[model samples]
Each structure stands twice: as C-alpha cells, then as structure tokens.
Target chain A: MRTEDFLRDITAIRGLSGDEGPVADFVADAFRPYCDEVWVDQMHNVIARKKGGGPKVMFAAHLDEIGLMVVNIEEDGSLRLGQVGGVDPRILPGQRVWVYGKDRLLGIIGAKAPHLLSAEERSKNYQREDLYVDLGLPPQRVREQVQIGDQVQLEHRYTALQNGRVAVKTSDDRACVAMMFEALKQLQNLRHEADLYFVATAQEEVGTRGAITSAFALDPDFAVALDVCHADTPGAPAWRTHKLDSLVASMGPFIHPVLRGKLVEVAKEQNISLQTAVVPRSTFTDADGIGEARAGVPTVLLELPLKNMHTTVETLDSKNLREGGRLLAQFAVAVNEGWEDELWT
Target chain B: MLRDTLQTLLGAYGPTGQEHLVADKVRELLSGHVDSMRTDALGNLIVEKFGAEENAKTIMISAHMDHIGLVVTDIEKEGFLRVHAVGGISPRLVAARKVVFADGTPGIVALEPNTKGKKEPEMSDLFVDIGADSREEAEKLVSIGDVAVYAPDFTALGRHKVASPAMDNRCACALLVELLMYAEGQKNTIVGVFSTQEEVGLRGARVAAYAVEPDIGLALDVTAWGDTPQTKLPAVKLGAGPAVKIMDRSMIASPYVRDKLFEAAQAAGVAVQREVLAFGGTDGGAIQLSRGGVPTGTLSIPCRYVHSANEVIDLRDMEGALKVLLQFIELA
Candidate 1:
C-alpha cells in the first residue's frame, strides 16, 4: 500500500502515551527508507533526520493513542479501568477490547443489565466507575495473566465509509503520523536547503513530553507540528470546528504567526485547501512545546481536521491527508536559511 | 560586599530578551579576574576561569541575568500602553507598580476597573501609564515590543537581608560574580555563564550547555521560601544558607551532583537547606538535559516572594553559598 494509505495499519498497532515501543518500531521502519538516519529516543520519539547545511526544520506528529489501563482486578476476573489519556466512558458499553496482559487476551466491557437497574440509576448516564471488563477466565487465571497496569485498548473496527472517508481508532494522531510519512516521500523529489527532521513524537496526550525533549535535543531553528483538529460534526459548536476536507493552520501566542502565514502561503500556492484556526492562547498541541524549546523556535501547528475526535471512531477524508503532506513538503522547500530573517519581518 | 555587587547589577536595565546590559555589567566586574569572556548568539556571557590542575574537567556554572518584565503589545488610542508579561509576571503583582523601560523611561502600571465584581483582571485589562497625554507622546517614549521591568529599588530589611525587584536572579548573578572573582586554583575549568532568557524558559542555558558541553553543570538561582506562614510545602527557610535542589518542574538534580553539594557544604562548614520546589525551574534543568545529559544540580538562594517587586534574600545565604561553591568546584 501507499504510505499515505497505511493510516489504518498504523492506527491498528497499539501505542498508548508513554508505552510506544511497538509504534516506534513500525514508524522507524517506515521512516528508515526515506531519510538519512532514523533513531528512537528513550522516550520512544521516532526521529528521522535528513541532513543539510542550512537551518534545521523539525516536523512533529504524535504517535500515542488514547486508551484505558487495568486499575484493579476483582475476584470474579473483572478489571477496573482508568484513563490513559481522554477516554470518553460514553462509548464503553459492551465493546470488545484488547487486553495487553501477560498474554494478549480479548475481553468485553460489562455493565449492569438495563432490566435490573433502579430508576434513579437508569435516569442518569453510566459512570466509568459503574463499568468493568470481564475476561472469560477463572479468577486464578486472570491473576496469573493480567496485572493492574497492563494497557487496554478500546475496540476498533476500521471502516471505509462513502465518499472516501475512513473511520479508525487513534486517527486523532496516527493519521497525522502517516501524513508526515507522506511528506517525507514527497520531499525526495523536492529541493530544500533546510535540514529536515521528521519526528513521530510520543506522550503528547499526557503533556507534550516527547516534543519537549526532542525539540530541545534537535534544537531546530523552526518547526511544524501536525495533529488532528476537531472537524465539523453535527450538534458540535460550529465556531469550534472546521470542515472535514480542509487542513488547518493555527495562530496564537505559542504558535509563530509568521510561520503559520507561511503555511497558508504554501497551501495557496499549491492549490491546497487550508483553513485558519485563531487559537487565542495555547494551541495545546506539540507546537506549544516545540516553540518554547531553547531560545524559542519559530514553530507553527498544521492540523488535519477529523470528526469524532478522541473517540474510537475518528473519521477523516483520506484525500486531505495526502493534500496536507503535499502542502508540508512544499513548505519544507519554501523554508530557506533566510526564512528566520523573514519571521521577524 | 556581595550585596554591593547585587546593588550594582540591579542598576542595569535588563529583561528576558534584553539582557545585554546585565551581561555588560557582569563582564566589567569579571574582566581581569577570568581567563576569557565571550557572548553567545542569545547574548549569554560565558566567562572561563581556567583551573590550575592537570586534566581538569569543565564545570559550567550558570546564573541567569534576565528578570521578569512586561512588553508593549499595543498602544491604546488614549495613550495607555497595553502590555503582556515577557516572563511570569502576574497582573495582580504588577498593578499600580512603577515600571522602567530599557532606556530609563519610567511608567506606572494600572488595571482597568470593571463592574465584573471581585474577579481578578487579566493582563489585557492592565495598561502602563507613562504620563503621556497622547498616543504620539507615548510613541516617543516607548515603541511596540519594547520591554519594561519593575523599577529597581533596593531596600535593606533589618540586617543580613535585602529586598529588591530583580533580586530573584540579580542576587544569584552577584553570587556567581563573587565565585568567579574568588574561586582560585580550582581543579575544574570554571565556565561561568551569566545566561539570558532563563525567565522565559531556560533558553540561553539550553543552547549554552550544548555549546559549552561541560562534564558537570550547576545553576545558581533563587528558590521560593516556605518559612512564611501558609507556605509550608517546600520546607525551606530564609537565612538558612543556600538550598541544594532535589527537583522542580524542569529537571531533577543528578543524585551524584546533589550529594556532592551536601559534601561541599559540609567541607565549607556552612548550613544548607534541601529545596523541593513544587513549581518553577532554573537553567540547571536545561544544562542537565543537554547533549547526552551532563550531570547537573542547582544551588538556590532561598528567597521569599519570588518573581515579585519585593523579592527578599538574606546576605548570609549568599556568603554561605559562595563558600560552598568554592568547595564544589574541587570536589564535584
């Protein structure tokens, strides 16, 4: 499959926020063929560097996904869950989950039957504390196979929807990761003077930790952070969402206004659809961390708009992913040694 | 004697991005005492005092020269200068306080009164009144992006204590200057970096450490005091000597370097506090994480009301810290 089309495969692999070894290995392999060098940091940040003699430009996209962890195991072989990132408990009823225990096991999220619930309890929404994961095994077997801290991924069923839209788990980020891979693929044919570092960062959901260290180590002169933004979904606040088809570029105090304008310029020149996100404060993305790295890097956040963000079914229009890659690749070409001087002007 | 040096440094007008004045002051003090001195791209003044021993390792000692300030974001039509914090300065702390621009032009910070009862005003609601009657007159005094810090006013608090606006870091800069002047026949190549933009995010030290690439690093800064009532968690006190940091939000102290600080304190016969700051960080956090990670620690002068107009520190703590740093260069 084309690298841009591999978002489903990338999202299928489990890589929770601080435990991204599996995701790192796959991302490193994908990046190995396209860049000068690829290496994984202690934080599992996959950094693929393309050496040049000009200013360094870092392109970052997080690889970690939202999930739950086994917080407790009852005597009846049921597991209690705590969120690893922002797992909405609203979608957890009777869903199949992948329990990454001593052995890979399948389990079902169980709740009280509606027929047996009291009216007071039934009137209210199901709280996460009211749910448990039932593994089909004896309590002793559960004790042997599972531990309290083992990662549990919510059920994911990748679906190809009508009009080239696709739904999959963890696409809030992995789609952007795949989009970076596509950018790397495109940069092969482009001419650029800047040293480019394509990084699949880890632990962004927790607090942009990977970007913090990676940006510090690389000390890039400029950076662009790619992540998914909430696309237009029905019943969602219209002012807060973007079209599912257009790529997003955010401007705020943390984001370099000039660098963001440069992305828009590139998008316009390349005939790619781009939208502006006027974030007043923190972008709450990797850009927030990368821009503050060292004496401060001129960093901008470019986003792919997806529907149903932070859910198991993050839906995206596949063409925009490829469009975002092309735009970023062209942006890499647009950045020269003089771009730093342009930022202040 | 160190209080005199701090008084001299506080005279210089320097904010986060504008630290050259402080660097110039530091260079003037340490000119003939050090082997070499230079400034980096970000205006960090790195001074070297060569060791008199064979095969000595390089130990980078950094004290940030930058202090908190507010920058002009826009000028309102009514001649008021709209501002935002360049560092971590709060609107509540700066309200109705006198501020000085880099060029010695002074202004007063004022908050707009709103009918929104009892709610704290934001930086947007705050403006600087430079006594300018018109926008044209305000433009003549300060331009957009020009920064202004709290007007410097050194106050002696009782004895062995002094309170000042930029004392959070100018005191540490004074201490480092004292170390460079007095640290003689040391076993390590002492690279004293009067770093810049530390209040912004340890930016100067991050790149400075990468360029210096020292075997060991230490940040001289001030830590918050818990001796004041209702401030109980940090467990540090004023006049209790300099604190050896355990950890802060930025980087955890390397255990080897942290323990060596205690040993140096013991050797110097100076009392020291153990600082565990729940918030705030220093340049040591950047130096420790630089290029394969050099072992680093911080020596903090315990100060009350840090990042305020009246940051207070004890002179005895500076004297004690100077003694310990002289021992640390050889032992660490």
Candidate 2:
C-alpha cells in the first residue's frame, strides 16, 4: 500500500472508545485484500486472520483515537465539549476542528481578545470550561445542523515535513494500526507457519478497555501491543521523553521476561537500532491486563516515538513507525518459524 | 469492643522496621485461636487456620501496623534533634506536638519562632526538643537512629465516636484480630496477616502476598469520610457504617467480589455504604496482582482526619465491618 494512502484512509474514520464501528469497517475493508479472512468481534475489534498450518501468531494494534465528545451546545452557537480520552488543554484554544455532525461542520475554538481580559483571568491557565467553539453559524442554525453528543476531531491537515515526519491528529495509535496494514500488504504471498490473528482493537485511548476485552477473548499464549511513546522536544521533561530518532525498548513489570528476551534476540539478528525505557512497574498499558489474564499470558509493548502527544499536532517521524513495523514483522516471523519447535520446547 | 486492645497496641512505639512490640502483643492475644503463627522477614504476623474442605482455597487478610512517625537524623548542639518523616505526613500537624521515642524518652516537636506566618514547617525546619541543654545529654536517653511518633491520648468524644493516635490503621489491626477470634470455630482456612511498612510503599504486603497466594484476599484499612467541614461535600458521611469499596485510585475491586459482599450484607441485614474513593491506595493493590491475580476486595472502617495524630472513628462503623466480614467469610 502507498504510505500516503494508508495514512489518509486510517485517519479518515472517526472512532473514539465505544464508537469504533466505522473504524472497524474501514480496517476490515483495507485488510481483506491481503488476508484470507477478515472479521470483526462483538466489541467492534477488527481481526484479519491469515491462514497458516503452524502455531498461532497475532499482530495487534488499536484503531481508536483521542477526540472530543460534544456534551452541550449553547444558544449563541458555542459548544461545551468533554474529552473522550486524554486531551492536552494547553493546545486547545484557538484551534480549528471538524465537528462530526450529520454533515461535517468546520469550527474553531473561540478565544477572547486579550485586550478585553482582566489581569486575574489572564494570569491563570486556560481551562476547557472557559472555552467554546465558533461554528460561524446562527444560533438556531447550529442547533438544527449539529446535535449534542457529536464527536469532533482536530482539522489539522497532514504535513509531510522535509525531515520525514507526519504531523496530524491521532497519530498516537492510529499510525501504529496503519503500519500493520502496510506489513500485511508486504507479506501477502509469503508461506507462514503460525496462524496470524491481526486485531485492530478499539477504545484503547480510554483505559485500554478494548485490548483488555480482546486479550481475554483471544487468550493467546503471547501478545504484543503497539502504542505511541513520548518523544523528546524543547520544553519536554528530559527524563520522561526520549529522542524521536532513537527506537526505545521498554523494560518493566508490564513486559514479560521471555517476550522481552525474544524481542532482544530478534533485534540482534535483524541488526536494528534500539534504546530502552525502564519502568518500575505496570506501564499503565494493555500489557497490565494481558499479563494476568486467564492464569497468565506473557505480553510485550513496542512503542513508536511520538512528540507532543495528546494534542492537536501530535507529531511523529513516519520512518520510526515504519521501522517499528519492520521490527514487529520480524518478531512475528521468528515466532511463527519456531513456535511449536523452539518456543514451547 | 476491640478499642482497648487497639489502644494498647497503638500506644506501643513500633516504627516500620521495629514492629516486634506490636507483633508480640498480637501473638499473645491470638495464640490460642490460630492453628499456627509465624513472622515473615518484614515482621508481618501471619496466622493460619485449617478449613473443613480438602484443598480449600487460602484466604489472606492484611492490616499494616506501622504509623506515621519521625526518625531522628541529627542531634544539634542545642539539643534539638533534626528528624525526617518516617511516612507521608503534613508538617502542619507536627508543631508543638508531643512525641515519645522508642525507649520512652519524651520530646516536643518545635519549629523556629522566626517563621511565624508559616502555615506548615517543612521537615527540614522542624526539630524535636527533648529538654536537654547539650547534644551529649540528649544522646544519653535517645540515639540518633531512634524513631518517635506523636503521642495522643485516646478519648471517647460521644456515644459512638472515639479519637486517638494511630487510629488510621490500629482499627484495621484490631479488626483482623477480632475476625481471627470470631472465626476460631469456623471450618475454612484463614490467614490473618498484620503487615508492617505499609506506609513505606506497601513493601510488607507484597512479600506476604507472594507467600499466601490466596484465591481470595481482603485488605482492611481506614477510609476518609465527609464528617468534617473540609471533606468534599456529597462525600461518604461518617456514622453511616463500614464502607464496601467498589473502586479506589489504586485497585478496582472485581465486580464479582463486590457483588458477593453486597449480597452477604443484604442477607445479614447490616448497614453498608458503597465507596468510590477518588484518591489514596491500599494494600489491595499488591494483593490483587499477586500470583497471576486474585479476586480481592476491601472492607474499610470510615475515619475522619486520617494520617494525623488525632484520627477519629465511630465504633458503630467497626461493628458494621465485623458483621459484614463474618458474613462474607461464611459465604465466600
């Protein structure tokens, strides 16, 4: 698949937590061309199964994105919004977004003119309750056009910079999902030993409920979850975020020792560049639940470097996501080739 | 009912690593009822009881015996002892308070008189004065490594309310002992573990959990309530009853375990409150994730002014907890 086409198609669907039906349908459509069978689960997770006569291997990523839920719309065409997942309030003011109404409506967050503001209010941090959206519509017209509880996403147009980075909304896990599709396209005609269950999970942004339920249902012997990692930038805490150019290998209570060892072996064999993020316990990811599900299931987390996450312009080097996909595909191949013979043995 | 024993235990000076005094007191009281008793590496008291069925699932109950105290770091020339907080504590509660060292040496915590407008003195600015003129004189009675806690006399405020020091968790330890005593005739295997160093990151419970590996685990502790003015309005009120926690910041209790507790409370006709604490954690965090996970729940005794020298609780809440817990053990 063309990288540009993959990015556009994956970012087009609106899926936030419980409302992942459209995103699942889009993923199933995109994955059917490369897999034997593609289906969705009761929880709206899209699973594209590649037929194989060997051990089962699952490549999983989340399809949901962090967006806003329109709670109430005021009489003067202003809307009060609540974040569906974690939304950084610092970047929300004066930002343009698309309100997912019956017909898409363009809106911009209305900020008061600084000249009119008093000294006390200006000294404080900006709050979501103090902000509203300007849809450029009359009071009655807006109520007639956009109802309450509609979802809204940032309308920042994708920017492919000279440095090979893609600036867009929902690059967090959506980009991870796109990489899986690209890998499937590349491995279409390959004869594999392990049965591949590629799951595009939903609602991972809101406390990893999608991954938790999916892991419980599948009950795989081993699992890997792909999510975005914080990238180093100006004003970022040096200790928390890593450099975008470096591929961080996470080690912690969330990562199983066997899975971590296997990842290290595969990276060594493939000669890939990798760094490490050592967490004391439970990285607050789907791996927490997957590690303890049904007696236990060993899990690993492979993070794609991202900068300014949970904001309108959450940026990522597209090449980093591509490399992450290569690493994951390599690990899948390694597991598939030696599953019953070496992994269990 | 258990207040006498809890006050006696709380009055004893037992810091994180020096919990032997309180553990020995519990050992003496509960020796006859338990089938066997042993102390773990962290000084956690583990008591066992045999069950009726063969290969019955082991159940573990935990309560930390450590209270927030001050650890001596330096003895200044003027006999003022520089101290560090043994656990998480606010400096506002330390000034002009009475503290007793491990060897019964008395002291008064004081802040510099120059900082008058200070709402609270940082641990660096606070010192304990044991009324000695020189460092040598102070060292005669107290060592540089001695630990001390604020001493508050227990008093009955009203018909059901009682105020005392270390009530934040002495109530929990007392309840565990009472449950062990009440379950002497029962058939199920019970492990009552009085943990240490819970305030220092739940280190004791983690080790105890691995050893127990129980199918069911219950953490007994005190929870905050809206009895005082500063508590958030529309919060859990005092005098209601024991709280059955559905969710807390640290651990989300399994819905199945929550429903079972609720069902048992209904059958016994006990007054119970459903709790959803916005902050603070419990030993339930480690217990729930132990040995590939265990179904866990918390039975909390609602207390006001927790982690303070003068924490208050209602005896009716304790009675309610005992009733619901006895019923749960029978049905679990």
Candidate 3:
C-alpha cells in the first residue's frame, strides 16, 4: 500500500500521548501483514517482530499527535482549552477542531470580530487563553454531553500540495511511522537476515517515555530512530532547517557514529539522497533513549524533512518519506554480525 | 453527606506540606469503613477498601487534601507582612481577601496602590495585615514559613451550588470517603489516597504511586469552569455533572481507564462531561507515569474560581461523581 494511504488512515484518528490505544492497534494491524508476530504493550507500544539469525534490529517512530485539551466550559456552551503537546496557540483562532467529547463533534475556534476589539486588542495576537471552542450546541445539552478535559483534536485536513507534498495532522512522527510501514513493505522481499522489530512507539511527544520503555523491552542489537525534521519554512531560522528533497541522518553524541556511517553508506549504495543534521546534544527523538538501553545499542537517527512542525497543516514531501523507507530497509540488511564489533573500531 | 464531609475537610487547616491535620480528619471519617489505612512518608493518607473477588485489580483513587495558601516570607516593621504564594495564588485575585492561619489568627490580604492606572500587580505588590502594631507583635501570632489560607466561609449559593476555599479537592475527598462507605462487595480493591501537597506539585501522589504500584489509577479533583461570565472554553458547567478528564498539563488519561469511566457513568445512570484541562494537574498525572506505568484517568468535580476564596461547586456534580465512582470500583 502507498504511504499516503496509511497517512490518510492514521491522521484522522485522535490518539494523544498516554492515550494511543486505537493508533497502536492500527499500527499493529498495519505491521501484521508484513511481519511474523505482533503485539501491543499496555503502554500502547506496537511491536512487530520478524525472527532471523542475524543481528536484532529495531526501527521506531512515535504514533502520538499534538492537540488542545478542554480546560473549562462556558455557560453559553463554549469550551476553554489548553495545549496537549506543543500546540501553537497562534494557529488556533478560526481553526476547526474535533471535540472528542460524548461524540467526535465538529467544533470551530472563533476569532472575536474586529468590530468588537479595541485598538489595543487589535494590535496584539490572541493568546491561547483567548481562544475557546464553539461546538454550536445548546448550553444545557452541552452540559449533558461534553466534559472538561476532553481532547480537542486538530481537524484532519489532508492537502496534497504541488510537487509530491502532503499536509496532514500528526504527520510529524506518524509520517515516520508510515515510513516504517514503507520499509516493512519493501523488506517483505529484499531481506538478508536481521531479526527486525518495527515499533510505533507511544508518548514520544511526552518526553520520549515510550521509547525508553520499549527499547528496554526489545533490547535490540541495533536501533534506527526515525522522525520528522524541520524543513525550511517561512521565517524559520535557516541554521535549524533542512530541505524537503532528501532524508536526514543525524550525527551527534546521542547517535552511534559507525552506525550512522553505515546508514549513509547504504543510502549512497541505494542511490537515495541523504542529508546530515549535526545535533550537538540530544537529538530530541528516540535516538537519545534507544542508544542508552541495556549497555547501549548502536543507534541511527533518520529524519524526513517536513514543514510546519506543530501546526495543523504539518507538510511533508512524499519522495523524502519513501526514500527514508528504502534507506532504513537497506540499513537493516547491511547490519551484519560484525556490525556490533565495528562500533568501537 | 458529601456536602457535610466536604465542609468538614474544608474547615481543616492543611497547607501544601502540612496535610496531617486533614489526614487526621479523614482518618476519623474513614476509620471503620476501610479495611486498612496508613500515612506515607509524604504524609499521604492511603486507605484500602477490599473487594470480594480474588485476583482483582488494585485500583487507586486519589484526592489531594492540601489547599493553596500564602507562606509568610518576611514581616514589615509596621506589622504588614510580606508573603510568597504557596501554589497558584494570583495576587490580583487575593487582594482584599480574608485569610486565617492554622492557629485561628485572621488577617486581610492587601494590594499596594499602583501608581499607573490599569497596571497589573504582582505578589510583590501585595501584603498581609493581621491587626498588629509591630513586627514583633505580628511574629507572636504568625512566624516565617507559616501558611495562611482563605478563611473558611462556606455558603450555599442559590440551591445546588456552594462556595468556599479548598473545594478544589475537598469535594473529591468527600466523594472518595462516601464511595468507601457506600461500596460493598466490589470486584476490585479500591485504595483511596488522600494525597498531600498536590497544590505545590503531585508530591504526595508520586511517592504513594511508587508504594502502591496499582494496576489502575484515578484522580478525583475539581476542574475549572467556563460557564461563569467571560471565562470561555472548557465547556464544563458547575451544576451539570462530574467530568471525565481526557488530558491535562500533567497527564493524558489512559484510554482503557478513561473509557471505563465513561462506561461507569453509563452504568450508574449518571451524567459526566469529558474534560480537557490546560492548566494545573491532579495526582493521576503522577500515578499514570509511575514505575512501568499505570492505566489512569481523572474524575473531576466541576469547580469555579479554584485556588481563590469563595471557590464554587455544585452538589449535583459531586453526587454524579460519587455515583460514577461507586460503579467504577466494581467494574475496574
């Protein structure tokens, strides 16, 4: 199946951190057709395994999404909200949201009319607190149904932009999860011998908690942490952003150098355009956590360049996401028995 | 009974780190109802109500006992006292508010005059006056590190709603205490933790979760309301019913546990709202991420003006939450 197909299916779901059950199930089902065994942990980490005599390898990307949470309810039936993850309040006003209350109700975040605002209020942007959701329900019915603390999801609007680009909610890490699916689809035929475990980790948005636990549970000989990187966006600093045409293999203290070198070599061998991201400290992905699991696992961090990092329209280049799959699949095949000993050398 | 229990707990003098007095009151109420009870290192009152079935899940329900207060930082020579907020006390809200120390010493919080009109004031712009002549006289009744909370002023608002300080959690405490007293032959072991220092942080619940390592966790607390005037969003109303927390700053409610709460509401034939709080946290946050992890959700009593004097809640919501908890313990 196409990566966009998986993205289409996954983006519409509302699975925030610590509440990724359905997303985990979807991932497990997605991997079931491509692997030998699959199971979801209590923490909702979907682990799909393929046994082999070669080195044990793990590929992971978080499956959770960022959204706003209901903080209060207005008597007139409006809903107050807070950020679930790094939800940009600047992008909130006039945006449509899915209120996951008694029902997955359609809600709109309204901006106060310019006529209603004073000159002082007009000069400033609305803070997150200034925004409230209007579910368009009666006040009494709203009280009967909606609860405080229900998640307000970013409405899933998949826009296929020019030049093989797709914008979808949760494309940040879920795009990488789809990339893992792409790798799995390719690995069905082009396998060497690595015992592969593809994990769609939970709660990565909440400080990489799932990666820490899942890595400890899987204990792979080699791990490849795949996630999205900031593609060049308007007003974003050039130093921190990458292009959308290629996949990025990050090199830093957290990433294993030899393993990264091996990934770069595989990308070169596979003729996939690969870029390098120099993260001086924490990669801020599963790479930091998986690298230190049980006397250290040789780990590599792969990045798919995406635009609009935390906004509803998280854009990504389909070509780069597909290239990431090929690179990861080739890396799994390239990780032979001597790969572990070569880390020190 | 929930109202009376809440009123009693609200009357107890317990600040963030000083919840032993509240715990004492809780013990007195629950002494005979629970199977076992103990105080943890953090002064959390942990009590268990056993189930009839064997191999049942260890479900922990937590309601914090501590209230937000002002700690005496320094005393002025003229007897006005300098203070720092212990929790989420807004200087603007506390100005001209009445407070009382644990020893029944009453005082009034006063805000310094702002030279610029329409300028926002801060804690530094505020002070406490205890009708004292000098620093020594003020020190005789109050000391440094002594906490002063909103003096108890419980008033019934209209019919269903009631107003007071510390109703943020005392309402939940009442819900838990009543659940323990009401539930019989439940299928799961219910451990009620009257946790300490939650207003400061989830300090008491953190250690309590480590000790209990429960199979599931639930936090009972008050959530903010948007029904009153300009406070838009959060969609929760006081008189409607209790709320089921979806996510908060401290945690994303575990789906299995949160969904079961919904089912429990259905089973109990009670009303419940889905909650998504942006600010503050409950003990469930600590319990959800404890050790490996525990499936956890929060049941919130819809409260207004939380952390301020005259915090308001509806008894109907408390009743709905108690009904849900009674059904929840049996199902979970």
Reported per model, the fraction of native interface contacts reproduced equals: 0.02, 0.00, 0.54
> How many clashes does each candidate structure show, in the order listed?
0, 1, 24
B206-304 in candidate 3: lDDT tens per residue? 889989989999999999897878875466788888988877778778888988999999999998887766667899888876765688899998889
Model 3 docking grade: acceptable
Ranking 1 against 3 by lDDT, winner: 1
| Residue-by-residue lDDT tens digits, candidate 2, A191-310 | 566677788986666556566656666767678777778998898778778878656768887787667878878888888777788778777666666667666777787777888788
Superior candidate under lDDT, 2 versus 3: 3
Q: Per the 3 Å backbone cut-off, how many clashing residue pairs does candidate 3 have?
A: 24
Error of 1 at B150 (Å): 34
Candidate 1 lDDT (Cα, 0 to 1): 0.88
Q: 1 or 3, which is superior by TM-score?
A: 3
TM-score, model 2 to reference: 0.67
TM-score of chain B, per candidate?
0.99, 0.95, 0.98
Clashing pairs in 2: A249-A275
Model 3 misplaced regions, further than 4 Å: A2-22, A50-59, A66-169, A185-197, A203-224, A249-301, A310-313, A326-345, B76-80, B102-107, B116-118, B130-143
Q: What is the DockQ of candidate 3?
A: 0.32
